[model samples]
Target: MSTWLLPESLADILPAEARRIEELRRSLLDLYRTYGFELVAPPLIEYLDSLLSGTGGDLNLRTCKLVDQLSGRTVGVRADMTPQVSRIDAHLLNRAGVTRLCYCGSVLHARPAGLLSDRELLQIGAEIFGHAGFEADIEIIELALASVRRAGVAQARLDLNHPGVPRAIVDSDAALAGASEEVYDLLSTKDVPGLRALQARYPGLRPETTEALTALASLYGGTETIARARRVLPALPALHRALDDLQALVAALPGHEFSVDLADMGSGYGYHSGVVFSIYAQGWHDALVRGGRYDGVGKAFGRARPATGFSLDLRKLSGGLPPAGKAQAIRAPWGADADLVAALRRLRDEGEIVIQMLPGQPQRLDEFTVDRELVLDDGTWKVRAI
Candidate 1:
């Protein structure tokens, strides 16, 4: 293997793609600011326990751990920034009333999350803390939709779910006391046979319970899916509340595409207590954004608050986006003339990218295209388009 070869699922973003990513980052962060979300930058690494605390087993598996040489305690690179931002809200700021926060940075995963995903991801997201209403969920979801639209997706789909739907049913049944993971797996995969077999393990379980669980796997579509769910599912209070929440979102957000999948909440839905969602586009197989309401995400930091947010994989979102318009630069000959130097500085200060030709340098096509040039035409230095 070559010494310069990168590890599996890790690679560099060359100039063209890097420019697009940077432009999109600036645009999205500015959007967040307009909504009053203050930007925050958390450390790239922190103590292992705090990083993994309250995030559940999936986050632990993805985190890359190492020992701190100075203190000998274990530390881990962040695989996700949401938890760290939550800590800032609860411990650092500790402010009363609602707090809106946004962040963008690189996170390292022990392994790639998907076949097409990189181990190192550029994650950007916004969170709303201290507000528990569906209004918070709507605001975050709208921001997510607006983000992808700005990135060049013509039409987007929002898949909504509530982990509490399954949790409500599972918690009330004594037979499923220790088999929560098994049931979640079966439902998420839509494995009817496995669900039936699990139900058979407890011979005295009611037939209605088994039927309801099996039906959830196929409960998906547009607004009609929500109606079908309400009619088919059992009448538990928790389940009713979950369905009502979905209904409220649909009512509030009109003209947006939506689908409901009770069985497929999300990767971290086991730990996420309320509404969960993922955004999809035409060509992408995986979600471009994933987030939901995880009310107590800050409990480990000592101040629990209602928090909801969504994160976009910058690499994933940048895939089909149009390239940013390159600035028209004036290529100048390498010289120390006072007038030329002053003009060059003035052009740079006015937001133009001026490429200075170095002595003995050969013009390369990959470097840049000369749209204009500075020359002493008729004894006056002026910019002329070629």
Candidate 2:
């Protein structure tokens, strides 16, 4: 028998790291609760149709699938929580007007091109359904920003964009409808040469459409870059609306570094109807959080509600963050008394790492394998140094 190992992209979370992740999750969840968002946990597996209802392209490819033996139908491991949550809002919750929901869970998916991480990742995010206007969009963006800040992501930058740039092009031309997916991917990567080849193949398209496509190609930079982009597509109303929405969002997040990426930078999820954004920290090349508005996706599942939310890649954040706390041994005195057990239980309940001594074993802080120590002496509990 060959014993090579587990897959390279997959990994296990050790005790210390897992504990830190759980602590971070609890802290963020508590913060989200303060903002009136109720938490929900959707099942990790669902009908393939429900999970892929509005998710598209890269997301669909990343999903892991299996056939249910009992039902004789295909089901998929949830690759992302947003689509699952959207399905929940549509089918289960069906909270007619509007609903605010948050979720924290692990998602499994195939790795995407250029992505270096595991197929299984832990995510924490929220979805706001049933609000349609720009005001609603702004609120979601602000919350996404605040959530990242609360996670101790110092020097976080928000990059905002709208899928409408390509949507406008595709909607204006009947021939482009089926080709929108290919065009969006090319534009997102700023593949100007490939875009030009597409334009050449579809010469009947309007010059304005080509200009919009070309403008989108060179639209990545800071605030001044956005202004420069405005000049390139001065007459595109959709572009202007997206720009205005971004401006308002930036204004709301004053003193926080924010920029507009006019490129076709959004995931091609059919549900994302308006502005989309990603958050990045100083040293990480990938976004720690990604979210946007998906106002019409709920409609496909039978309810017509507007929705927006974001997910934090917990693994990515943990990798980038400093070590949670210093490592040290934990010690606790051993005694044959009910009070000692009660105190040990209380310490464990409070989330302190503790080690209990065996009978006849001396309690030395250094001998215990934990961060802190507790001593029970004369009906009093004291924390001792290792």
Candidate 3:
């Protein structure tokens, strides 16, 4: 094997894609700032328990764990930043009022999320803590939509789900006490046959209960799905509330494509105590963004706060977009003359790309195209078209 060969699901991000990802990161962070979201950066690696706090087994499995040499405790490369941010909110900031935070960093997944996904992700997201109302959920959702739109992604669709909807049904059957994981797996895929087979597996499970579970598989569409869910599913208050919450959110957010999937509530992560959402768009193989209300995410940090936020892989976001054009640069001859040095500094300060050539340097460029040149024309340094 070539020494330079990377791991199966990981690879280095090249110049063009890296540029696009960085630009998008800056743009989205600025967008979050416009909404008063303060930036926060947690370590790339931290104690496993802290990183996985309030999250689910899926995140644990995705995390790459190792023994820390300093403390001899098990630490893991962070697979998600939400929990770390939650800890900061619950323990560090300790603010009584609303606290908005945004983060952007690299996370390592133990394995590829999908065939096309890389093990390394440039995860960027914004979170709102200390707010419990649907207004917070709406803000998070609106921010998520704005993220992809700002990245030039068109026709973005919002898919909303509440784990409570499925949780209510799962809890209604006492026989399903320990089978929540299996049930989540089956429903997320809308596997009706699997739900039907559950009856035989758990003999005490009711036929009507299984039917209601199966009904959820077909209860997906536009706003009408919520009304249809009310009629088809059992009249459980918890279940209805979940549906109503979705309805209220839909009402709150208008002029965007919305859909509901009671069967697929996304990665509950064991912390999403309320509405969860995923953003999908054309050109991307998987969801472009995922986030929502997880009120108790801070509980594991000893202070549960009403929290809602969303995150997206900048690499994937950039991958779906058109190629980034090479930056236009001014070519300058190698010199340490005072005037030339001053000219170079001025152009750079003005946000111009200026490349200084070394003596006998080869004619090559990777990220910049030399469209203009700086020269001492008529004894005065000036920029001229190439």
Candidate 4:
């Protein structure tokens, strides 16, 4: 057995990486605030039932569960933040009108057998509750696209889809009733062979149903792909409406690139009652951002609210973003005097990163490789760049 005690699929975020992640998060959160999204933080742990109510299919199965020591009741580490935010809006905020909320935190999930998964993920997202209209959807999409640009994700594409198409097809074909989970998985991954096998197994399915499923299996690419898909599955009303909504979104966000994938592009949460999307960057294998409409999730917690939003993985975005600044050393030996401490605080408050000196360290701050040094000389403070 290995002597190391680290949990499977989970790792620590060291200082350099952590700092970059936080800086990106701050930029995104500030952008959210400028767009009128207020910040809110929910507890990291919640009762298992409340947490599970916010997810569906594979997500519910991946949650990490445990017994709360004090309450003696089962609790779960949140697999995502959307549900907790829903609970807050419905139960606490109880605002009569629309409310915009944003959050940044870590969510936990267990690695499933035969699947690639990360146990710990840092998410930053916003939710717009109590609004239901194509305008709202367009605004959310634009905001998500804008945030990705602000985060330095060059050449990002938003792949849009509607669960309604798949849901409608499945409802018309009895064989698809209990098969949504498996079919959706395959569609999202573009697993054509698997989809063909599924089609063969359910041979009694109608031609239109099969055609829609097959179209989804092959549906992925740029704007041209969406036009081709429209031809392949011509009779789908739900698909048509979804496409129209997406077209409106694209028009609203002129100059930004996007595409529509008819496939079940993976649902955001148990509450996502409408359009869903995943964002892809040039170098990343998976989406850097994912979100959609969760029209009824708030109602499950006790109110009827129509809302939508997207969450970005800060760490993932860092991987795609260009390096910000060169690594600079931090000064030390901040002196034992109160005035010296005040000087250090001023630098820190001014947004400069400061490192305090350990005992018996070098007295001359210039001995280090820092970009700048804050020092006290004759009861006055001086800052000099190296």
Candidate 5:
């Protein structure tokens, strides 16, 4: 194999895409700051147990594990930062009131999430801990919407779901209670045939369970899907409460396009305990953002806090955006003269991209446009348009 050959789902980010991703990181992180979210940068790797704490089996499969040199213990390259941040909230800060935290970093997934997805992603997100109110959920969703909007995304649609809804129905039956993972797979993919076959696979499976699972698959559509769920699904208390939570979320955010999918047991970390959501826009093939309330995410760390947040892959977000324009620059001749050096420093300090040319050197720039030249105009260096 060629030494330069990269992994199947991993590739180098060229200058153009790298620039756009950096710009977006600055913009979105600043947006989180405006909302009082403190920025945090967790380590790239940690002990497997600490890294995967609170998050369940879903993350374990995605995480890349290796034996650590120092301790000889299993360590995982994080595929998600939310759990690490939860550890910080529970163990480090030990705060009493609401704590809003935000982070942006590269996460390595063992495999690509989809046919065209990358194994490495620049994950950026914000989380609010210590608040269980719907207000927190609303803030996270609105911030998620604002992030794409700030990036100039248009016609973005929001899809809402409560894991509790599907979880309630699954937990109601013995056959499904032990087979939740397989059942979740069928529901998430809308495999109605597989769901129907559950009865034949498990003798004495209730007809009501099969019918409810089938109906949940079609229970995705406009906001009306919530009301339809109430009328069609069984009147389990847990199911009703889940429906009520969805109703509250919809009522809280008026004038936004929303579709409810009752069958989706969130595919991420699997710690979602309440309202969950995803953001979909026209340019992306799948959801651009995913997050929800994972109230007890910190419980494993000895502190339980109500949490809600959303995250998007900056690389994915950048891919869908229009190509960024070339950054403007000023071309300068190579000189060590005191005045010339002073002028160069001044221009650079003033946020100008100044490229100093070497004698007989070829101009090489792919990400910048040099439209101005710095010349020694009658002794004093000055910049003039080319």
Candidate 6:
């Protein structure tokens, strides 16, 4: 019934919140820059094939697609900026060494992915291309932590996992190989009964593999979890390597609260091949920042390279920060006095916000806080703080 109403989960950001979000965006971009991440602004829309390239099936499902009037081919409004950045690195830049890229913009989702998730998100992140060691993973995770600290969310919790852990366990067991998706869902949701049923299906599998598959459901919490995993999990090469990587990450991030969770896999499992992480602040129910190693994400672009990055919702991160101070406004009366015009121009040049009143119009204090007023005192124009 309301013609001017916004679509569900899509709403306008008014001036106050918009200003705060902008400030946070600038701060984050600056942080990324200090770490050698060059700023990149990818177009909001692109061909469906490229947008979904190497991103994963889940992204395709989340993207909002439309037919291009000029090309007659299906295109999609980006639901994520990572793949676009991957294309830039793999196809456009074609650089062999490590290339650091950062981006901040809105991505439209076909539907809200979570209860409070927006159809449009102001996503900001940094990606590192061409490094494939545990050191690269450590760097990105530390950078993400520093970003949260920079955003004023000091009490942040980091959760780390390697999807390879579960993949190794599942693949090692022949009976469970085909039903990995069902098994993953059960583990992700902590469905104990379903996992028990799964273990029952593979009656003749090796004791260690079966034990590890069932143990995945409970491998969560502090450093002790990693220790427990090393003890319980089979010594398969992939599984051991995943545990070692997680251990190395924990050792690097000293003085920060973190957990080793094998069951923390999400929809991006196929895309993020190693060392997944999510950061949570004290007040937020959802992750303030998330990323991990999606090495070889550039494969589809024809030159596969190791890549890892993290993104945070500007609005959500700003929501956890203290309110920003309002800019001081100096109210100036309309006049032809050369001195007054000169003073107004000087103030503007000095980065002051001066609101000039219209000729014969009344001053509206409600429109802005008049911190000061420009007036003629003793035949000389001056600015006096109220």
TM-score to true structure, per model: 0.92, 0.86, 0.96, 0.86, 0.98, 0.90
Q: What is candidate 1's lDDT per residue for 1-386, written digit by digit as tens?
A: 89999999998998778878888899999999999999999999999988987876668888999999999999999999988999999999999999999999999999887688789989999999999998999999999998998888877888998888888888777778777877888888899898888766987666777888898888877778888988998888999898888888889888877888889856672458888999988878788899999999899999999999999889878875655455556799989999899989988898877888899988664535679998988866788898
Which lDDT tens digits does candidate 5 get at residues 191-282?
Answer: 99999999999887899999999999889999999999999999999999989999999999988889888887755678889999999899
Question: Which of the numbered candidates is closest to the native, going by highest lDDT?
Answer: 5
lDDT by residue (tens digit), candidate 4, 109-190: 7763234445788889998998887667777887888888887778788888777766666676787767877877887778
CA-RMSD of model 5: 1.2
Model 6 lDDT per residue over 1-50, tens place: 78999999898887777888888899989988888899999999999988
Error of 1 at 129 (Å): 0.5
Off by over 4 Å in 3: none
Model 4, residue 94: C-alpha shift (Å): 1.8
List runs of model 4 lying over 4 Å from the truth: 1-5, 112-117, 224-227, 234-236, 323-369, 372-386
Count of backbone clashes for each model? Answer: 0, 1, 0, 0, 0, 0
The parts of candidate 1 lying over 4 Å away from their true place are 197-210, 322-327, 365-367
Clash pairs detected, candidate 1: none
lDDT of each: 0.86, 0.76, 0.89, 0.76, 0.91, 0.84
Clashing pairs in 4: none
As for TM-score, the candidate ahead, 3 or 6, is 3
4 against 6, candidate with superior lDDT:
6
Candidate 6: clashing pairs of residues: none
- Minimal lDDT window, size 10, model 5: 262-271
Judged by lDDT against the true structure, how good is candidate 1?
0.86
